[model samples]
Target: MKKSYRIKANKEFQHVFKHGKSFANRQLVLYYIKKPEQTHFRIGLSVGKKIGNAVTRNRIKRYLREAFHELEAGVEPGYDIVIIARQPTKRMNYHEMKKSLIHLLSKEKLLSKK
Candidate 1:
């Protein structure tokens, strides 16, 4: 995913968390806030230390970024989204993680009908 489509700043993540609505599945929690002026969606990801070691956490992040990239076309634009991986994700593969994320986004109507 491109840097422009990522939520990098701590302040940005805080804004999304504080103002956004949330949804979750067993493996992930999603927070989102709409920004109508934005041309595309932006994402932030969090994988807590309690979930795993550094390598495992990094792997989870990579899977999430790739999933978002692949789902970019169908996801609603003009929103800032934050995803927090849960303990169950530590044992998941990329496909499973993607599926879990899709479930959360779909619940909130963030993934556009395709």
Candidate 2:
């Protein structure tokens, strides 16, 4: 992920958690809030221990990050996005995960019309 697109600050995360609207599909939960900046969009991924071991958590995070990279070009500018992985993600392969992520983003109208 590029530095400009990364969600780096604690304040940003907290703002999203507190104010962003959320939607969930089978594999992931997405939270989004509009921000004033137009330069770039920021994204954060959360994978919890309740889902699995460290390996599984890391694997899920990696999958999510890759999926985000693929879809990043379609994302609208000036938003904060947070994706939280669910237990179902442990059983999903990369393609399935990617599809789910895209589906969720599309549902949220975050993805630009294509």
Candidate 3:
């Protein structure tokens, strides 16, 4: 993911967790806060050890990045978005993960009407 699009700071992640609205499913939890002052988005992903080893966790992040890339056009901008992978997410394939991500984002009304 591009540096501009990824949310890399601890403080930013905390801000999202503290202030964002959340939505979840078996595979993922999404937290999002709208930042009207901004013109773009910052996204973060969390795939902890509870889900898997480093390799497994990295795989999840990779898949999520790709999924987000694919859906980026449809997503509304100006939000800080965080995606935390759940235990079940460790075993899912890219398509499943993509679907889960979209579902969660859709629930947040983050996906555009198109």
> Model 2: per-residue lDDT, tens digit, 1-114?
887777768788889989999999978999899988666788898888999999999999899888878887898888989998998999999999999988998888999986
Q: Order the candidates by lDDT, highest first.
A: 1, 3, 2
Candidate lDDT scores, in order, read 0.95, 0.89, 0.90
Over 4 Å off, model 3: none
Each candidate structure's TM-score, on Cα atoms with residue i matched to residue i, is 0.98, 0.92, 0.96
When summed lDDT is taken over every stretch of 10 residues in candidate 3, the lowest stretch is 105-114
In model 1, which residue pairs have backbone atoms overlapping below 3 Å?
A: none
* N/CA/C clash count, model 1: 0
Model 1 residue runs over 4 Å out of place are none
Model 2 is weakest, by summed lDDT over 10 consecutive residues, at 36-45
lDDT of 3 by residue, 1-114 (tens): 678999989999999999889988988999999999978777899988888899999999999999988887888989999999999987899999999988988888899977
- Which of the two candidates, 2 or 3, achieves a greater TM-score against the reference? 3
Q: Is candidate 1 or 2 superior in lDDT?
A: 1
Give the per-residue lDDT digits (tens) of candidate 1, residues 7-33. Answer: 999999999999999988889999999
Best by lDDT: 1
